[model samples]
Target chain A: MSAALVVLRKELLDILRDRRTLLLGFLLPALLAPTLSVLVPGWTADQREQPSPVAVVGAEWGGDLVYGAQLEKLIRVVAASDPEAALRRGAVQAVIIVPPDFTAQLARGRSRIVVRYNPADQNSLFAKQKVFQAVAKFSLSVVEQRLQQRGLSRAALSPVEVHEEPIPAGGGGLVLSLLLPLLLAVWALTGASHVASDVGAGEKERGTLEALLSAPVARPALVIGKFAATLALALASTFVAGMSQTVVTALAPAAWFDAAARPALRAGAVLLLAACAFAIAAMAAAWLLALSFFARSMREANQYGVPLLLLVMIGGVAASTLEGVLSSLWLAVVPFVNVVVAMRGVLFGRVDPAALALTLAACAAYTGFGLLLAVALLRREAVIFRA
Target chain B: MKSARVLVRAERLAKRFGTFAALTDVSFEAREGEILGVLGPNGAGKTTTMRILSTLLRPTAGRAEVAGADVATSPQDARRALGVLPEAAGLYGRLTAREALRYAGRLHGLAGEDLERRIEGLSALLDLGAFIDRRCEPFSRGMKQRVALARALLRNPIVLLLDEPTAGLDVVAARTVRRALAGLRDAGKCILLSTHLMAEVERLCDRVVILGDGRVRGIGTLAELRGEGGELEEIFVRLAGAGSVV
Candidate 1:
């Protein structure tokens, strides 16, 4: 164990001094999350705040439905002789056509409104949504007016009332939860790839493996030490990434996070996230180390690592895209997927202790298996002395 | 007179990579206070023999020992007693020579003040003061070789295995290595040195083991093998056969 610690210290010192490892594992990941977090929200806000113009046909016959209360504040309604041409020419994002007899039908309590917009166009889509909101409000006012004329209470317009309330409801945390797993997994892979390949295949290519093997330290000690260094790097990178994301989210405007619905960034939650990140980092580092041991050179190790990284990324994406708790017992033991699910559960304050335990146990098991494989590979003369 | 104590012993050691025999029935011994030379052509199994003694490679058919520790059964102990500089031993390019040496020392159980002192001593002994603090990446081949040699010697093991230590060095660098080997030998360390240069073998070896085609062609003192007037080269060529020396 002492020998392994020595090896770990040396390997870490060596890796830290390497500019390539520092850049890829530490600097890049630290910068990526904050940069994206700020830029994406800013861009989305700009898109949402922009005015959406729409063209209206038969404006005289459309009556108050076309010029309803406060509609002009949200949308710019323009009268166009040829609304389709105006829409196609980009003069308007959408077009609303009113029939010539639309006033007669409304007096008899019947009418139809046609909304035309290109779904593929973002501006058109936004315009369509604004028009729909205005129309719905106008229809509600007409119903209230008719009820008043009949001398009936406004409540008589509806026999039933419905209200929606989400379970474990929150908004700001939703984005963070959706992003944390993928970002952490990516950081883990980035960190592990840099250190694991350098220690495993890079040692062989540089001819340093023979000297290390000839030392009094056993092969398992050497492997464990290298594995520890890689794991440390992996965990450090993920922590930095997670921290950057948290800081960025906290600094963002309340409008971006729905302040009332944002969950407090509590110490217990942060600690749980850190624990999950550590488990993921350990699993990533061990697996990458094992794969790299089979490679004869760093280049070959990178080739093997790319596929594993892709697999991790896909698993993270799949988990984040899944709705609800993701507390299925089977998914709790599925490596990277489990961590993502557990992270989601933790962020939303709906954690299933049993599932989290299973996930952690599974990660521990996989990490152990990976380390054992790495040790076995290190002991092989063919691998250690590969030409 | 005190009997010579053998520090390294390879008894009928053999190694096979699949069906190809890299070393066959190779046997030799190096005693304390002596420098034993392993002389061979490029593909003559000299490196294979050195690797087995260093506990870096396991022999297929025989056993070896370093400082009385079995290389096969107790490899860690055997390795603990051996300082190995394999052919083309490479350094961590990102590390300074001092850091590299310290790392190697720590691996051998040296630490703190002892490791630092060992590094200082080796840096001075190998004339590494000029570049010891520089990263090894931009080092010349000769400078790297010196650092590697320093790393191998840092632990001061009972047995030293140097494979082609000066194979690609300039005359000055080669002389530096030869001087270091002589110093270690005089300090009573058993050194097993493999080389192709006849001059290196003639100048340093107390006894020479000439190998050819994975087999030992001859093992004896130069005087014994040279007879009354034969040159060491002629004897080597005669024993190892024609077209063997490169």
Candidate 2:
């Protein structure tokens, strides 16, 4: 154990001193989550705050429909002789063309208002939504006017009323639940990948493996020490990412997320999330280290690492999509997927002790298996001293 | 010679990579206070023998021992008593000589003040003072060899296995290493020196073992081989099969 610790200390110091490894494994992962959290919401807010430009064709005949409503305040309405050209030139997000018989159709109590906008353009899509809402409001006001003329109640227009009630609703925290698992997995992978390859295959290529193998230290101790250093890096990255994400979520404008669905960021929940992150990091570090040892060179190790990274990403994506099935105990036994599910459960203030225990136990088992494989590989002269 | 204690002993050691034999029925011994030179041509089994003795590679047939510990069964103990300088002598380019030595010392279970003192002693012995604190990246080949030698010697093992220690060094650097090995031999350390250079063997080795095609060609003192009626070069060329090619 002591020998392992010495190796761990040496590896950690070496990795920390290397600027490239430090940047890729530690610095970048910590900064990415916070940067994205702030930038994405800020950009969304900016887009919403800007007035979308729209061209009102046949405004003379449809002046009441466009100008009478409060939509003009939110959208910039312009008169364009060639509205399609204006849209193509990016001058307008949408074009509202009123047919010459629009008033006649409205007088007959049913009018078709064609709203054309580029679906590929995000601003155009936003403008289309805004115009649709304004037209619906105008149609409602017209119906109420007709009812008043007929001396009847406005309720006659809608005989059946539909209401939507979400089950166990009122928490907008689902967005965080969906995003946190994927971020943690990414952080764990990025943190462990470079360092794992450097320590394993890098040592072999540098001709240091023979010296290390010739030492009095047992293979198990050496493997454990290396794994410890890798785990430390992985945990540090995940911790930074998780903390940054939490801080960003807390400081972000409430309008950016569902106010009702926003999870209560309690200390207990945060602690649980941190525990899950550590477990996932440990498993990932060990697994990555094992894979790296199979490589004969640093370049080869990186090549092997790419598949593990892709696996993590795929697992994260699968977990996010499978959130509805998180209650399954079987998923808690799956490696990367389990960590994501358990983290989602923790964030939503639901702590299933059996599932958490299973996930933690599974992670521990995988970590042990990975370390054993690494140690076994290290003992083989063909693997350790591969030319 | 019979009374001298044997620190490194190999009895009919053999190694094979697939069907190709790297070392076959190779046998040799190095006594304390003596340098046993392993002379071989290219692709001979000198490195294979050295690797077996260092416990880096297990012998396919036959047994080897370092400081009385069986290399195959108790590699950790054998490793503790053995110091190896490989042909490449690769160093971590980013580490200073001092740092590298400390790391090697720690791996050998030397720590704290003992590790520091060992590093200091080795630096002084190897004349590493000028560049000991600098990263190994800028060091010349000779300097890297010296650092590698210091790392191997840090544990002060009873047996030293050096493979082509002076292979790529200039004349002055090679002489420095030969002088150091002579000094170590005089200090009663057993050293196994593997190389293709006859001059190094004549200068430092008390006994020489010549290998050819993974087999032992001849083993004796220079006087014994000379008594066989040929110069050292002629005897080596004939026994190592280089004469046939010429």
Report the lDDT tens digits of candidate 1 across residue range B1-246.
027898888899899999999999988888998899898777788888888888778899989989999998999889888899988589999889898898898888888898898889888878899999999999888888889999999998878999878866789878988998999999999999888888999999999999888999999888888876688888888887747567
Cα RMSD to the true fold for all candidates: 3.9, 2.9
Real contacts recovered, all predictions: 0.90, 0.59
Pairs in steric clash, model 1? none
Error of 1 at A165 (Å): 6.6
- Model 1 TM: 0.87
Error of 2 at A318 (Å): 1.6
Can you give the TM-score per candidate against the true fold? 0.87, 0.92
How many pairs in model 1 have backbone atoms within 3 A of each other, for residues 3 or more apart or on separate chains, i.e. clashes?
Answer: 0
- Output the worst ten-in-a-row residue range by lDDT, candidate 2 chain B: B237-246
User: Which candidate tops lDDT?
Assistant: 1
What lDDT is reached at residue A274 by model 1?
80
Worst 10 residues of 2 chain A by lDDT: A166-175
